[model samples]
Target: MSQQKSDYIDEVDVDESWDEHPSRDELEETVENLEDSGFEVEVVEDAEAALAFLQDEIPAESSVMNGHSTTLEEIGFMEYLNEGDHDWENLYGKVFSIDDDQARADARREAQTADYFLGSANAIARTGALVAADLSGSRVGAYPFAAKHLLVVAGVNKVVEDVETARERLHEFAYPFENERAQDAYGVESYPAKELVYRQEGTEGRTTVVLVEETLGY
Candidate 1:
């Protein structure tokens, strides 16, 4: 039996080799520090606020950019985007393969124009840095860096204690999850779809995390 891309995308890598994970409370503290320094932090009680915030606060005119965000899909982001007549572009639209110059040019130009960007962390460290695993060059840096106002939609399940926990979640949670998810969602029938795995190309840009009350994702 073979694995599917969508299945993998929904599951998290399970690596035992990484150091022991930290407690949820500890991770929250680190995230607090990040908020104090520069990043903005907002914790929502449930999906209702998230949807309302996404539909209203997240500029109706801005071209909404998306990444590997099942959370967004679950929340009906496309409907909101379409209902508002906001333009959008992402890896889904020839987002998998684009040259570097084109990527940078698009990122620099398109990002500046967008009033808001709707994306989420592959993993959210309680420390506050949003982690993302992007195998495609388009999602590598363009999505996060380009958006004017970044909204990191997260499920309670994605939260971790620190960067190390974030990394472990990537290896243990991210790798295996993304591997199987490429199928039903995108017709990718391969598990651990090499193109969607996290390689840590570089650091993420300014981001605000939206932590849901319930668990979500692998």
Candidate 2:
């Protein structure tokens, strides 16, 4: 069955303008505040630069894993992990390659402990808080503390004025697209059963946010 736009958004109403790109000044302020909140922030020109930055950040032979993220797909990180000349363990690829269902599940859980874990945020508040929701905890489970290092990649369009607006963006924008994707891919509906609101990074250099200038993901 084909997905419909109304299938997701009908559950929660939100302002359509929340999806617009932020101004340069707004992006700059958000970056400063994110840095003050203890998250390493990098502003890339586009998805290509973001992908290149990711390649440089991760070292060879390190075990790497990632949650499902359209931003990462847009940046070609997923394809690179599968087909490129990276020496990292590529834990996600390994987990999916397992044929046994239980073994695959076990591998997925084990992947949370990978040296580097990457994903995208639903919304990033100018106040420096990050918001994301997931149907299963597998993706977000590593964000809090499971993974050794975390990288959250997002587009400038995900930035908002505050935490409240960030929440709105998740419900209005992220949820709808994600729900449709879940149905089409998994033949199941998705919900925000697991939600993450990252207000600060207590450990220095534990997490980094790659904010691309272009509009990239949900």
Candidate 3:
């Protein structure tokens, strides 16, 4: 869909602190302020800590459901899990994409049984809102409700100005990643993500977002 055609969405402009991209110093200040807003905050220097937190300390269950994102692979996630620590009796991505029969089964089984869930976020507002666009449903659906605890991991590049820009960034960047995610999760290369995401409107769920300071995938 054309960008303008996608304008019938809720409009929330970030007119307060993040009217523009926060500088390094401003970014720290913003993070501090956001942490004070009743949300748990963890700042990692680079992708290494993010990787360790995701694959090791977060939690390990028989099933670990995740989106088909390149960031996970870039951080040596598959290697880390394949090498050791992660149990071998569970599933990963089954229906998170329109993949073939085995891939579909993998995603469905993982989402059904996984106690620990993780996925990349397109943007993390200073208000601690986790934003994403899910076509295969891995971005937010499984992470927010299916998992015991949700860890929203995003590279520094995903951090944007405010809520409005965050939504804009989804169209600019996330859709493409979703396209790749579709290809990997299935095996087809023509699937593009639909612009529908689930948010925590009236749920008392806890979502942990780890913001990294280096450039990473979408």
Worst 10 residues of 1 by lDDT: 192-201
Model 2 TM-score? 0.93
TM-score of each: 0.66, 0.93, 0.69
Model 2, residue 176: C-alpha shift (Å): 0.6
lDDT agreement with native, every candidate: 0.55, 0.89, 0.56
Write one digit per residue (lDDT tens) for candidate 3, span 115-187: 6566667666654455676665544566545676666666666666566777877765555555554454567
lDDT of 2 by residue, 1-218 (tens): 22333445555455667669998899999999999999999999998999999999999999999998888887889989999998899898899999999999899999999999999999999999999989888999999899999999998989999999898889877887898778867999899889999999999999999999987778
lDDT of 1 by residue, 81-187 (tens): 54544444432333334558677556544544354666666666665565666555434354435556667677766766667767667666665566556544566
lDDT of candidate 2 at residue 58, scale 0 to 100: 99
lDDT of 3: 0.56
RMSD (Å) of each candidate, 1 decimal: 6.8, 3.2, 8.1
